[model samples]
Target chain A: MERVPVLKIGDILLVSIQIDMEDQTALQLQEDLADRIVETGCHGVIIDISALDIVDSFVGRTLATIASISRVLDAETVVVGMRPAVAITLVELGLSLPGIRTALNVELGMALLARERDFEFKDIDDDEDDADEAVVAAS
Target chain B: MALSTDEVGRFAGLLESNGDALTTAWTDAVATLLRGRLSHAELHRQIAELQKGFQSALAGGAGDLEADAAGELRGLLSELSNTRARQGFSATETAVSIFALKEAMLTVLGQDGDINATTLRDYVSFSAFVDRAGLFTFDSYVRAREELISDQAEQLLELSTPVVKLWEGVVAVPLVGTLDSARAQVVMERLLQTLVDTGSPYAIIDITGVPAVDTQVAQHILKTVVAARLMGADCIISGIRPQIAQTIVALGIEFGDIATKASLADALRHVLRKADVNAGRRGAGRRES
Candidate 1:
């Protein structure tokens, strides 16, 4: 099984998915990401899927799972670099992936993560609406 | 109608012998019907080209217009109709030119001598052949007209949805006309793609030129905004007129947390202020306001 590398950038963990992930690969990545967040105590995780072309429901569910897993572990999850075609497909497929923040690219994804950190600093329990507003502003 | 090889040979000889006279008669007949819509020289040139195509086809022993020998003639006729269709000539005018040759042929055939029974039989077949040609001309004209219309529609689609950058990290799509499903899909795709390309985290969909907002139009716009959000870009819908606003409330269509403004400028200011606030420059912009 191919493995997706997870790199640590400062206070955040960046996972650039450059391969078409098999079911096993995605599950493994989720497990590995959870392990790394606990080990490094990172507060944010950015999943970059810009290299992906066809994002089926399986991938969509995996992304949602990753977001939730990271959230439960006290790390904010931002899914960035979603292609226009992929977004349209996901929308048509009715998989909006709620609660997962998105940015146009990895750079903006980092900025969004930074802002989310700022929000966390200001408020211990962040407001859901406020988080979405930060997404709009940071994006 | 089908022409026998022998009769086809005789007709080809007749066309070649009286080439100039046949073209003159055909052109004059068509010019009168068209009321001088076409230049005489262009009409003459087209007539001459068709004549040459016909003579060559018959010389090549074409028993009917559908024969392989008539390929050049079909090509010439298609070209004539294509040009005439684009030049705004009616289908009838275009087909009439082909039918006019029947009169020119009959006049030429009668000038030779007394009309024999076999010659009359041949004239009937030849007249039928001209009818077939006339139908072919009409078909080509209609085909060309349909192509022109479809091409124009495609060009209009391209012209209608242009995603342009309004400022740094901001883009806008000024929409006009009714929003159909196909157009909505296009606008959505282009806006999202532009957001990805320019990394413009903010977008403004200005509908100032849009005449009205129906439920379907509102649905399309909402879908676009949602799709943009998925791509990590925020879309602000701008240019809601008073009547459109009333209609939105009447329809109970909720924009739901998406920012909207009265004008393009307002939307721009909103985006700039949000951007400034996010970039940690909120104090200065808020103080100015």
Candidate 2:
């Protein structure tokens, strides 16, 4: 199976895919990229899939999972330069890339990552409380 | 064997006619036998017997069609039993957590010192963990304890805190506890909603229970006040403890044009005086007319 290539730029890692996603290969590529991101110890990652013409459910779900897992590891992930057609296709398929950060280009994504680090983190205390309350109510 | 042709023909016709009656009689006899064997009471007994057999077959680990049906029933029963057991466990855990929180609060109060932040934080964490484990009763208990501490803190902060009917507002909310971003957001929404519902020109918010004032809390308060003003209501901040005041001044946080009264009574007086002035103006106009 053909796989996407992962590129490293200093502390930021870039994963780029050129193939039109039509099969399970796309999902496999996503998993491989996620695994590499964990092993590379990169602080930030930018996924550039501008070359792909179509994005389907498997690809979208994989990206969302990768983004969520990256957050758990304290690594920031950004999806960059998504083609308009691919974006529309994904939306039409009712596939959403939740939890993944998106930017028009890699430069902006890197800038955002830097700014995020500089800002004082707002603690999600309210969310934690709500979750606690929900748990309690469930019990 | 040597019969006349007419006699044989007549005999054949008689046999054909009797065929229908004979078939009917045979059907009736078979049906009667079946009814005796499968009467309502008898069928009920047979069904009960089948159920017992199924249960035994399942227990004996038989794997035929009958056993499969029994296995499915057993699975369903086991699932129901497990769910009930889990529910019972959760209820018990909630009760235990509530008790623990109450005990912790009593112990802290018994010390007769200022509310220890560290101790309170520990209790909050414990309460949160219990809540996550599906103990909801403990949540209310924890909230109540926090409210008690907040009430005390408010009293200590300003003795002159008064209940004020600012412009006949329907609901007066006395906020207590540390206002994090999320809590602040909730407070903001609640105040705005109350203002919209009552259509009051003024709302007196007694913040005497607040132990600390952070930048986030200050911003939230400002946002609430501003939003209320936009909706044609004034938000009055009252019962400012000395420490909170000191914190605000030290941090150089600004409230801009928002009104901050020392007490709710003062805030109420301000609104009532405005109402009186408006009423006086209307009376003068009426007299002239």
Candidate 3:
């Protein structure tokens, strides 16, 4: 089975799936990704599926599994570069792909992961909380 | 009943000899019906063209408009009706104008003073042919009107769903009027496509102009938000009126985790600050207080 490659940039690992991931290949990729996260001690994982055409229920479940696995391994998973058509198809199928963080592109994914880190570190704590609450309540 | 070959020949011969008088009578009757909306000269020219079409078709022995020899006549009839349709003439007026030709031929034929049963029978057949032509004009007028309506509907669909840039990483879609399924689909596709094109992280859907918040409209909005979320963009729905809010609560519609705002400005500010937090921009510095 062909393996999906995992590249590390800074503290984030990028997984750009360029092939049609068979069930076995996807399982193997999950295993490989978990191993890399442990080996590099990275805090963020970004999955780029912009080139992917069809994302059925099987793909949705697989992505959710990947996200859960990353969370359990102490890393944030952000799926980036999803095509609009695929997103619409997934929604029409009623699969919201729970447990996955998404970004418009790889750049935004990195920023999201960075922000996630900031939220953890507790530096801008009180102000961020206040603004977040105001956004929810003032509207 | 279809006109006989010799009857068609008589029509052609009458048009050749008394064409000027027939066209003038036809134009006068039609002009009176139209109430002078069209210029006298333009009306004269159109009547002349119509007469020429009939003259040529009869000369070719076209007993029926459907016959191959009357191809030019069919083309001219459709073209006249189409232009008149666009120019806002009623279908009845156009059909009646064609019917005026029958009366014009009757008056001209009477001037010949050759009154006989055979001539009256021939006139009856000619009147039948003109009635068919008038009905044909009505059909083409209706067809042209329907085409114009559909074209405008498509244009309106395109115009109504515009996704505009709100900030560097934010976009907005201001929706107006009724939120039908078709328009909802258009809004969703355009919003998502703009999200991809500009890589906007946040989108604000302003529905202030939306007259009501029915279950279906809310469903459309929720589906759009969910779809955009799948593509890694946040959608904030803004511009909810007080009445709509009460209706939404009454309906027990769950917006889930999607954020809603009371106005477009609030939504914009909300997204901008969130974007600042993500990009680590100075927009976050205001929080130092």
Candidate 4:
């Protein structure tokens, strides 16, 4: 079985998909990505898809799945470097990949992820206050 | 009446022997029909060439014009019709040019006197041949005219849709004419390609030049906005004239989350604000450093 290598740079996991991924490879990558996020405690994941020329509905779904699981694991996922043609194709295919963040390049994606992480930390603080209010009501 | 082989032989001989007289007569008849619309010198030259070509084509088939299956004469007629079409000649005028040859041939044949049955048979066969050539010319003319019209239409479509970069990270496309599906597809591709080339995060689609907003037009705009969004760029649709806005609302056409402005300047202002926010953030960072 082929596996996409996930490299960690600082607290971010970088995954550059360089091949036309089969469904199995995409699913496997999604699982592997989640495992790495948990094991390494990465705060963000940037998937570079500049080399991905074509993406079908299955691949698009897998990307959305990966992003959702990463968010649940408290990791921000930004898929960067989508070609204009691929973007058009995805939309025409009715797969807008909602909730999956994207950027023009890896540099911009990194900045976006960093900024989002700051917002997420602030959100966590607000959630704690809401949790306290719920506890008092229950008591 | 069909000509016997001998009658065909004599007709071919007469055309060759009287080539100059037949050409001059043909040119004169065409000049009257054309009414000096084309240059006389050029018209004469073209008529002379046709006379020479017709004689050769006739001789090759032994005056049996229909037997020349390779369409040697028809090729010449098509060329003439195409030229006339481009020169703005009407179908009637083009077809009449081919018919004029019949009058010229009959006049030349009568100069010698007394109409005999054999000569009459040859004349009838030649007249049928000329009629066939005239119809062929009309067919070619219609096709050529249609091609010319379509070519101009395509050029107009290209001229109307032009994408321009307005700011460092903003591009604008001002559209004119109806947003038919073909034109919409072209506009979408050109705008998307420009977005990628400029790496612009913002796009302003100005519909001020557009005439009306119907349900289909609204759909085209929505599709373009969705496609742009998928490329990670925000789109602002401008030029919502009062009447157009009313129509859109009446039609219950929803634009969803895409931004709409009343004018290009307003759209520009909106784009500048968004672009500046990113720039301002970087500027603030530099100041802190």
Winning candidate number (TM-score): 1
The 10 consecutive residues of candidate 1 chain B with the worst lDDT sum are B280-289
> Each model's DockQ?
0.47, 0.01, 0.46, 0.29
lDDT of 3 by residue, B62-150 (tens): 99989877889888899999999999999998899899998898889899798899879888988888888889989999999999998
Residue pairs with backbone overlap in model 2: A139-B134, B154-B208
| Ranking of all predicted structures according to TM-score, beginning with the best and ending with the worst | 1, 3, 4, 2
What's model 4's TM-score? 0.84
Model 2 residue runs over 4 Å out of place are A1-139, B1-171, B281-289
Question: Which residue runs of candidate 3 sit more than 4 Å off their true CA positions?
Answer: A1-3, A20-28, A123-139, B1-3, B113-117, B250-252, B276-289
Per-residue lDDT tens digits of candidate 1, residues A11-88? 788898999889899989989999988987778899999999978988888889999989999999999999998888
Q: Which is the better candidate, 1 or 4, if ranked by lDDT?
A: 1
Candidate 1 lDDT tens digits, B1-289: 5898889988889899998888898888888998988899988998898889989999999878899999999998888899989999889988998999998888788887889998898888888888887899899999999999989978988999999999999999999888888888998999998999999999999999899899999988988888899989999999999999999999999999999999999999999988977775323223453
What is the Cα-based lDDT of residue B214 in candidate 2?
A: 86
lDDT by candidate, in order shown = 0.88, 0.54, 0.88, 0.82
TM-score for each of the candidates: 0.87, 0.31, 0.85, 0.84
DockQ category of candidate 4: acceptable
TM-score-wise, the better of 3 and 4 is 3
- The list of candidate 4 runs beyond 4 A from truth reads A120-139, B1-10, B62-75, B110-113, B278-289
Interface RMSD of each: 2.6, 20.6, 2.2, 2.7
lDDT of 4 at B155: 97
lDDT of 3 at B16: 86
Residue B12 displacement in candidate 3 (angstroms)? 2.4
Give the per-residue lDDT digits (tens) of candidate 2, residues B123-146: 454334323323333343344445
Report the error of model 2 at residue A64, Å: 42
